[model samples]
Target: MLVDKVAEILAETAAEVIEPRFRALADGDVSEKAPGELVTVADREAELIIAERLRGLLPVPVVGEEAVSADPSLVKAVCSEPAVWLVDPLDGTGNFVAGRPEYAVMAALIKDGETVAAWIWQPTTRLGYTAELGGGAWRNGERLRRAPAGGGPAALRGVVLSRFMPPDLRTAVDARTGGIGTLAPGSRCSGVEYPRVAEGDQDFTLFWRTLPWDHAPGSLLVTEAGGVSARLDGDPYRVGRDVEGLLVAADEESWQQVRRELGLRPVDLA
Candidate 1:
């Protein structure tokens, strides 16, 4: 089974710490970790819970958002380890501090740079997604499978759009269909949208930048749920030090159609 029970613990603990402090105050005591990055008590506390749990459960190593940014080698070593965990205790800290319920607790187990198991939990929504290599994906206790996307223009059916997408890409997408419907879900919540792709709620996801922790867990869920998960270049995605890439996941036909529409290349499928 090879599932890491500690990941479940991390998700549960992170959710517990996050929901209460989401919008504890208007001030929210926000701080800057980098020029453009933001942080809060919730992020640090959640990371602490996840990192401690990983240190106890795994003999390898962990790469977390809050505590390890100062040490690039730590991230590199963990990403290169044959077995490691990529964690984003609070994926959408900015949204959390802004009183949004879209943030989530994300964890993924990687072996040989490939994701073996993943869990993404939204504490406020109480929706949890989990996937094991070949066990299929599940939400709560029920298994999930991709639903049909009607053979109409993608834009007419409320495609979940990405924020700050380049103008040319948006135009090309819109030209292939009608105006995209208002279904753009934010990425602040862990791996929420990946399951949405599996559930047929979100037509596709286009990410210009996604770290190991951001996509690892949810990508497994999407594929296990009878959808496709791969880089924009259509290559098998591998988690590594600061490796950022684009992804698109959907039902087989729609996935292919979207890739063609976007002029994307195919990856070697497993």
Candidate 2:
């Protein structure tokens, strides 16, 4: 199956390109793609290796993070192409550069603007997660079902990525978070955050930026595991769309609970 092939490719690339450079980056190996946005040699090399292998397997447009960084127009393929591969070669470049083990390699297969299959591989842990549109999600080899919703709004534990949110919205979210059980600043890696939410390690997650490579894979994983993922306005998440404020939780009930607790209402981003 194509999903299986893609999974193998991600693992192989992580082993051959990503893992070796974990803390071995030279002075010239890392550079800023934008102010404060870092990219490393491993990110570029791994994206090339993964993109090539994916194209070889299916001959489709492969929109990788590093590639899109060089040419933003490449991302348009996600909506225009019949089938496209969205790849994040090194998800947590900052963490990896800092010698932290919280990074991952992530990819999602989008067909007709919807995610069909997804994969996330954490090199340090040798853990791989895959999810198909209807085949459900799995980790390593075990099937995954998000833990049942537990506790109330005050007991909810979550990670909120509010860095990109507008000042007023950020302050609003911060003030509201006091009602939740536990809140985190996020791991700075959607690849890691998505799986943690799916497995119930965290009750929910909120993101202001809706980049396809970052959210596509994880969004499918969480939803396929019997969780809920949608825009803050409660719209279903669609790949390649321009919107903001995503809230993902372990289940529908928890989803609504968090939405209400956070005082989130639908906003017209248009």
Candidate 3:
């Protein structure tokens, strides 16, 4: 299976490139790709290895995070190409650098701009999550099925990724957080956050930035696990779309409740 192959590739690449550098980065190992955005040698090297291995499996363009960072035009392949692979070599670089065990390596196979299969591998825990378009999601060979909807707004627990949100929107979301059962700052890693939502560890997650590499893998996993992953306006999440504000929850009812509680509306990026 392609998902199984990709999982193995991610795991092998992480073991060879990522784990060795965890908390052992030298002074020259890290640098800024943009203001406030960090990239490390491991991220670049792992991306190269993963991209190469994926291309070998299927001859398609690999729109890896580091590759897109180097060549912004490559991002267009995500939506324009018939088939592509989205790769996040090292998610949560800050946590990984700080010796936190919250980082992961993720990849998603997108066909016709929809994620068909995805994988998230956590190096520290050696946990691998895989999901296919119609196939269910799994963690370490165990199928994942989110608990049924049973919570109202006041009983919901969630995380809000507001760091990239507009000030007005952030203020609006913050005002509504008081209505939920529990709200915490996210793990700052979609690889971790998505699995948490799927496994019922968290009831919901609201993300302001909808980067394809970051959300593509996890969105499929959440939905495959019987969760709801959609945009603020209740649109299903599509890879390569330049939209913002995605809300993922344990079920459809919870998703709608969170959207209403947060007072979220369709974003106008223009």
Candidate 3 residue-wise lDDT, 1-270, digit = tens:
777899999999999999999989999999999998999999999999999999999999999999888899999998889999999999999898888999999999999998999999999888999999999999999999999667598888899888898898788778888888899878999999999999998999999898899999999999999999998777899986788888999999999888888888675343
Cα error of candidate 2 at position 80, Å? 0.8
Alpha-carbon lDDT, every model: 0.68, 0.90, 0.91
TM-score of 2: 0.97
C-alpha TM-scores of all predictions: 0.83, 0.97, 0.97
Model 1, 230: alpha-carbon shift in Å?
1.2
Query: What digit string (tens of lDDT, one per residue) describes model 1 on residues 10-75?
Result: 557865777767668447567888876888877877887877777777766778877666565666
For candidate 3, the C-alpha RMSD (Å) to the true structure equals: 1.1
Better of 1 and 3 by lDDT: 3
- Write one digit per residue (lDDT tens) for candidate 2, span 1-270: 887888999999998988888889888999999999999999999999999999898899999999999999999999999999999999989999999999999999999999999999999888899999999999997899998677888888898888998888889878988888988778999889999998888989988889899999999999999898899778778987788889999988899998888888886244
